[model samples]
Target: MTPVILTVFALTYLGMILGGLPFLKLDRTGVALLGAIALVATEAVSEQAALAAIHAPTLILLFSFMVVSAQLRLGGFYDWAARRLGALPVRPLVLLGALIAVAASLSAVFSNDIVCLAMAPVLADLCIARRLDPVPFLLALACAANLGSAATLIGNPQNMLIGETLHLSFPGYLAQAALPVVLGLLVTWGLIGLLTWGRWELPAGVPAPSVHSDERGPNTAGHPEPGRPLNRWQSAKGLVVAALLFAAFLFVPWPRDLMALAGAGLLLTSRRLHSRRMLGLVDWELLVLFMGLFIINGALQQTGLPAQAVAGLAAAGVDLQAPAPLFAASFLLSNLVSNVPAVMLLLPLASAHPQGATLLALSSTLAGNLFIVGSIANIIVVQAAERRGIRISWRRHARVGVPVTVATLGIAAVSLWLGVGAP
Candidate 1:
């Protein structure tokens, strides 16, 4: 049973890294779902255990926020934001700064991937219309979203998981993360501005790429209709709800999940927007992916192999419970398997150390900018750009991503070590 469980775990993670098994139609989500099914069929994990393994708080919180994000999207808040940012009568570098600031601030409270998804297409079109190269702005959108999300536990999925499981002080974590995140965002802006210096437009006589839009792909961005005006009332409603939720998460003793769920319910009971439309905007695939990974990871933990591996590593002086080792490992594994799975794998180790949660959150989130596939936020921005015939190749992305990642991680490590005195 142990070997069988290990096999299932290995295969599932392999799928996660490869985005699916070769010669099969499975994507990461599909592969994850199938892995859970295999474990159940083999009886390595009982139904009762499986049910218990699912973390209700995390899922509820995640689902509730998706509804909230959907409301903002449908309300035209994100579109309005992009237009307003692009319309500023400022130089390209200043406009780039504004883009980074807006993206990072929004992502601190909302879903980073959704923020990128909503902003990318509109930004691409805006750049094309203005005769400005959209590549740097698009990259800034992805990079800032990932960086800003590190500011708070609720900023990204992995951060939420860490916060909920560890029961770390929300305000405390914010204090620890705020410095690194702010610095990181600035670093991202500087790198992009420097790299694209004086090359902010396409060559003469070359027309801007035609922007594509359809309802086919996941949350596709179709061509914008003329004068499809902003719904101020709806936008205000979402903003107020989101602001209140942020306050509650920081100050109130109430469970964050319940507060978020209440917020979602308020938005759902709207008089104009249909519940179906709002729900349709939800990323159901992401929800399924989380649940599947939870089940598979839970089953593997039951087999005790993880504990054995930890002991073996500790024997070689690679103790994960220490902040320095965990910090380095989190950065590496996050770039390797992406952040969520990396966090899940190292979470148990972080649980025993005082600074483990802080180290995990900062390192994992910041490390995502190291490569395009290091975070879902990056993937969302890249895919959204590609849809509009604006290509951001891996080489192009790494030029900005690599230096920004290294600088931010160093800043975070030093800040954490100085503040927490972790070795």
Candidate 2:
């Protein structure tokens, strides 16, 4: 019974790596849920133990941050940034650098997917207005976001998972991730610049609406809502709350999730903006996805498989404490199961080695540059591209992705070696 239960568990997760089970209509989440049911049905784990394995702190932390991000979004924060960026007057290269920088910075704080989701169409429209091929610019958006989000624990779901599970210091993780993230963004821009060099033909004319599809009905800048015309009072309130939150992250001696949640709550107590409106902007699907993956990963842990896998790798001359296998494994596994799941799988093993968690976070994130499907930010750009009649196929994406991955990973490996400590 143990063998059969374990076999089913392995097969199910392997299917997760492929994004689905063979001959089964199941996505990664569905595959995970199925595995859990099988484990329960076969009595491999008791109901109580199964529940215990699933980490609730991580889930609560994830959901709370989503609320904070949601508050900003409903306030038209991202759309405002997009329009501001789009409205800028600068040379193409300057504009490109700014776009990458903005994407990275915003993604480093909020969910990268939401950052791209709100920004991609606006950027697409920006490209059309400039008569540039939307392909490379949108592609840059995805890669930049993935790279940027890797910079902070709050940036992407995976980083949060790694931080919570490993109990990494919020500021400490940032120290490990900051350099690679900054460098990665630069490399992303360079790669995009070269790839789109000849590709930028000015669109027919300087005319078209903005590309922000899911934005609020009226552009806050364009149409004043009778009285809510970008009040300094409200904006100041939000900024004050956010700034204090950042300071807390660096200096406050508390769990990051709780601090962030309190900040969100502070922002929620608005004089004008209703809580319901803010709540609507939250990415519930993503929060749900995190919860589901947590339970599923918990089930896998119950089987004692990760321990054995770690042992096997250790005995086989795989010193994860060393940079080589650690780097390679982080990169490969990130692409294998997507970065979030990959982080969950590896966070446990990361405990066995020095600086393991830091390397895991950096490598998993840089690995996102390997493929279009490698990160949620990538898909946002891809979907937005499809809407604009521009397609960035696997090959087209790989042209930049392959080189970007190699170059950035090389830089990350060296950086990790230096500041991440000795083996």
Q: Give the TM-score of candidate 1.
A: 0.95
Residues 17-53 of candidate 1: C-alpha lDDT, one tens digit per residue = 8989999999988988898888888898888887888
C-alpha TM-score for every candidate: 0.95, 0.88
Candidate achieving the largest TM-score: 1
RMSD of 2: 3.5
Largest lDDT belongs to which candidate?
1
Candidate 2 Cα misplacement greater than 4 A, ranges: 22-25, 202-238, 270-274, 420-423
lDDT to native, each model: 0.86, 0.74
Model 2: per-residue lDDT, tens digit, 247-305?
88888889877777787788878778788887787766566556556656676676687
